[model samples]
Target chain A: MSSILKVQGINKHFGGLHALNNVNLDVEQGKVHAIIGPNGAGKSTLLNCFIGRLTPDTGTVDFDGTSLIGLKPHEINQTGVSRVFQTPEIFTELTLLENVMIPALAKRDGAFKPSLWSSMAGETEIRDQAMNALSEVNMGGKAGMTAASLSRGDKRRLELAMALVQNPKLLLLDEPTAGMARADTNATIDLLKTISGKGLTMVIIEHDMHVVFSLAEKISVLAQGTVIVEDLPEKIKGHPKVQEAYLGGAHL
Target chain B: MTVEQSKKDKIMVIGVVLAVLLGPIILNPFGAGYPDLLQKFVIYGIFAIGFNILFGLTGYLSFGHAAFLGVGSYSAVWMFKLLSMNIVPAIILAMVISGLFALLIGFIALRRSGIYFSILTLAFAQMSYNLAYSVLTPITNGETGLQILHGDPRVLDAAVEDGALPVTNLFGLNMNATADVSLLGMDIQFNAGYYICGLIMIVAFYIALRLFRSPFGMMLKAIKTNQNRLNFTGVNSRPYTLTAFVISGIYAGLAGGLLACTDPLAGAERMQWTASGEVVLMTILGGAGTMLGPILGAGVIKYFENIFSAYNESELMDVFSFLPHWLQELVVSVSSLFVGEGWHLTLGVLFMLIVIFLPGGLMEGFNRLVKLARGGYRKDGASASAAGKVTAE
Candidate 1:
């Protein structure tokens, strides 16, 4: 499979500490790739670099043949790279439908549309697409509910719907199951599986082994700001390097 | 955009029009039906409404909006001095000039948000006020203010008949012209200028209502909620906020122009920080995010400043005539601090009470009254639903 996202020789430093050291990763098209690591493993930092939230010390992040090094977050999103934040970053003051519709409207009209005089009522196409995305996440019934009033799980689902409405090619999920209950995590894994069935590539940074093993076709073990093992999920289970990195080489 | 919303907008427009048209009759009962006070009501109503679009919807409290109002007044006065006595060109020039000023201020102020943004705008306004009072004296006419002069060139106006001072007019309809009608032992005066300002205020209100319902308005509220989410959603919110700032500035300018149209003088004191605070007070007191809130707040504040302040010790004694002598003496001594020249003391206390009790302003008070009138309050469901509606803004 062709690589949809290619990160080569990526390095980032915060003050005197090395955050990401010569990191190299490739996410294949239409595949679920999990980046599993311990705390302070630079997983979120790497994700931030990919989404233009941070500028790396030295690196090349290639998404669909375009360099995402200096682009704004909104510009990077426009290139069909959507991110579901670790903490559900939905518009809390807006309705669930409006929360989903904002990204959809941005996609339809662009980063800036002078829609001052134009009414939003005529945008039936965008509304329908947003509604469909909400239904895909099983949140279609509470479309009119205020986002702030939603439960944590429902807010996560609404945020997922918002990302989905953009119809992005590469979805970056940062700990999609972070703080979720077992049943909710399982439901999320099922939702990810259904999304994967539609042939969308995803890069997930997760701490939960069950979620990582269940959803990821390929797994990469990261520790001390570098990848220690890259292999299939089955092979990663028995990897010596991954165990050493996680257990501090004590039980060799 | 929905049928219900459209109907609501229609009703709001009709209601505002009716109110403005009959202000003379409606306000007569409160002894504030005269042209001068009524004109102040509508002018400041426009000012507060414009201020609300930025502060209410976007949650950006600019403490420098009065600078734009002062700019509009100066521009209108200049137009009157150079062009003609007609108010059309003057008002139009005021809006254009203030819009440009807003563009510059907004471009810089929007770079920093929250308290920083407020500080930047306040600084700009203070600078403008000082310049207008001193350095820009040639344009602003300094501390004495810019007023119509006899030796000036009113290019479009005809020669003054019988050497009388030139008066402002709308295509020969004198703005100062008034019709008095005696009704129920009270005299009602309706001036042409008040009606002109009143009409413009209605138009401004309608535009504000449309803006509140528009998608652009939704985007603004989203910015207020979570600007980071909007940026990540692939939408740039700066231009939207700048547009709101300019639109509001234009509204302030229009109000300023209307002030000039009525009085024919532009003062540097209009740009003072206290003037900006008054508009902020009006918006918050009425209801920042509601359509009717700013206008209601403006009316209340203006009525107290004009009508309530006019009451003397004799009037107070007349009001307290029913009470016993000791009670009257005790009440007058305490209440004296809140009326006459100390009316601001009453306003300050009222403002404090409203902020402490009803943070949502008079609109929230009205909503609670309605809820109480309906069937008394339920425990959780009512407030929860109300909170849901608030967040939906």
Candidate 2:
């Protein structure tokens, strides 16, 4: 597969403490890549840097052959890279359908369309697409419900649907199943597997070992702001460094 | 229930339309006595609606919006003095100046959110008010306030007797014509000033309504709800917020200009921080985030401020003179507390009650009542639904 994303010599610092150190990775198009690490291992920091939320002190993230260093997060999203936040950041006051429709509306021709004397029905096709996205994530039944009413897992699912409606080329998932119950986590894993089957490239930062093992085609173990191992899941499971860091960290 | 709700809304719209149409006649029941109170309601309604656009939807408490209002009124009055007695130019200038002020203030205020943001706005407004009170005396006319002068320059419409445009016609209608029509035995006067203010209010309301639902508006809502998530999603919320602030500022400007047009005067008091606080009260009283709420809030407050406050003990005595000596005095004293200077105390208490008991303001309270009347009240456990709705916005 062709490489869709390339990260090189990524380094970040918070005052004197180094958050990320020389982190490098290449994500192939249509492949699911997972980044796993103990808490404080700079996994989120690396993802944030890629999406332009945080600028690395030394490094570059190139997505689809375009430099992402200076672009704003929204610009990066417009460029086909969308991030699903760890916390489901949905418009609480809006209904599920409205939340999905918001991002969809942003994709319409005019960024600022007159809402007065203009019916939302004008965007019937886009609305249907948003609804389809909801259904894809099994949130179709709750489409009319306010976003704040959703269960934690469902909220995450709704957020995923929002990103999917954007039809992004590179999707970043930050602990997608972080707060889900066992059943919900398994469902989320199944959902990710289904999406991966459809040829979408994904980079996921996950803490759940089961989820990380279930969906990731490639695993990268990060510890102390650096990638210690980049290998197949089986190889990662057997790697001594991965065992020493993640296993030891997990035990603690 | 839906049918009943629609009917209620329809009734409200009709009532408002009728009241506005026959405002002067109804206000001055004993002929042309004090129609000024009705005019104040419309003017302040415009102000509160503009203020609500920022504070209500965006969840930004701006304590300096009055500065924009003052800037607008001053600019408008200057326009009338320098150009023509016609209000078009003055109102337009007012909106433009207020919008500019908002742009500058918003840029500084938007740099911070929450309490810091509120303080920044307050400081800017206070600075403007102080400058108007002192340093900008030349333009602002100092403490005595600005009024139209008889010999003021009028380059645009100088009663060109030779071969120029006639008395500045606003949309081809002479502004000072006495055209009164009889409606339901009451003389309804369609004056230029009232129509101009009403037209501006309509336009402002339309623009606000559009902004409330637009993609840009949705983004502001996102910013209000979850700025961090919006950032991660790749949306720069600052520009969106600034744009909303500017739009709201323009609305306040229009209201300020209308105020000047009605009275042909502008005062430094227009930009006081207390005026800013008044709009906040208006928004909370009428229900923030509701389109008609702020307008309703403004009307209510203006009614109390102008009409209720005008009443003294004599007015109460005139109403209940049939009572005995001691009881009549007692009635007048009690009535005085509810109206006039003491009205603000009632406003403050009412505002607090709404904030505590009806946090959603009049709109939410009305919504609940409608639901209850329709037998759609949910069970006790269903409070989750309402809680969810509240948190979502």
Best by lDDT: 1
What is the per-residue lDDT of model 2 for residues B1-393, given as tens digits with 9 covering 90 to 100?
Answer: 123334554575556566666666766553332335555667777888787778887899999888988998899888877887677788779888888889998998899999999999999999999999999999999899998766677777656434533343465565444457776776666566565555556656666665665556667677777776666565667777788899889888888887777777789999999998888888889999887888878877876676667778788899889999899998888878887788887788788898999998898888899889988778633654544343232
* Candidate 1 stretches greater than 4 Å from native: B1-3, B160-162, B183-186, B376-393
Per-residue alpha-carbon lDDT of candidate 2 for residues A182-233, written as tens digits (9 for 90 to 100): 9878887898899989999999999888998999999999999999999988
Q: How well is candidate 1 docked (DockQ)?
A: 0.52
lDDT by residue for model 1 (B257-295), tens: 989999999999999999998999999999998888999
Which portions of model 2 miss their true places by more than 4 Å? A108-121, A249-252, B1-16, B22-34, B160-192, B314-338, B379-393
Report the error of model 1 at residue B142, Å. 0.4
Question: How many clashing residue pairs are found in candidate 1?
Answer: 0
Query: Using DockQ as the measure, which candidate wins?
Result: 1
- DockQ score of the complex predicted as candidate 2: 0.29
Which residue pairs show collisions in model 1?
Answer: none
